[model samples]
Target: MHPITTVHYLALSAALLLIGTVGVLTRRNIVIILMSIELILNAVNINLITFSRIWHNMDGQIFAIFVITDAVAEAAVGLGILIALFRNKETVLADEIDLLKW
Candidate 1:
């Protein structure tokens, strides 16, 4: 049996990021896209914490904390925007949004 290593953690993070990327690209719903973005951010946090553990340093963890804070703010703003858009447009489809189109 092989022992798990940092490589394993990194691979998992990569997979998560890939899934998130696909979701963001292929999903038409705005809320799902926002969730996918959060997933990508979580993958980043996983990598940061994993590297911090391997390096025996606090920097990665600190960065992860910052990332979490940013994610929270992003979620709040994203949901707020989503609500506003829904109220004005009555739909969540990305293609249906044209408020900024020229």
Candidate 2:
């Protein structure tokens, strides 16, 4: 059996990261931004796992696990912020929020 090439994983991760970035930059909805952030986190995990496989080391895997944990925490915190914003503004649009005004 042939060992997997690292390029495949890197390419996929890049694609996911690009999509997430585009979503973050283009989307007006706060919820979508949070989801885009999650997408970026998942792309980071893919990169870590791929490097781990290429090097035959556990360190990358360990880092991937940490990234996953961080992603979860970030999601929770981001959602909480979105909820608070929605409560105050009555909308989820990024343009609708004015933290400096309040």
Candidate 3:
């Protein structure tokens, strides 16, 4: 078998991005949306690390670590908010949430 290349990594990243975008756009469940957002972030991390490896540079790796850190923070905060919303609304459907409405 042939060795993998940057193009292969890029293709995988693109597929993940497309799936995440579609999930965020089409899903009504808040949890699924959050997962999709995570997927998108992961795709970005893959791209960053892949390029970093190819160029033998540390910048992309450092940036990927930052992205991972941010993603963890985001997931924590998002799940907390989701828990609060579920407690108050008794529903996890995104369309049914109107907590911000005045």
Worst 10 residues of 2 by lDDT: 93-102
Error of 1 at 54 (Å): 1.2
| lDDT, model 1, position 48 | 100
What TM-score against the true fold does each predicted structure earn? 0.94, 0.89, 0.93
Which regions in candidate 3 have their CA more than 4 angstroms from the true location?
99-102
Clashes of each: 0, 0, 0
Residue pairs in clash, model 2? none
Per-residue lDDT of candidate 2, residues 2-82 (tens digit): 765788789889999999999999999988988998899899999999888878999999999999999899889988988
TM-score between model 1 and native: 0.94
TM-score of 3: 0.93
How far does residue 65 in candidate 1 sit from its true spot (Å)?
Answer: 0.7
Residues 47-99, model 3: lDDT tens digits: 99999999999999999999999999999999999999889889999989876
lDDT of residue 66 for candidate 3: 98
User: To one decimal, what is the Cα RMSD in angstroms of model 1 from the true structure?
Assistant: 1.1
Which model is ahead, 2 or 3, in terms of lDDT? 3
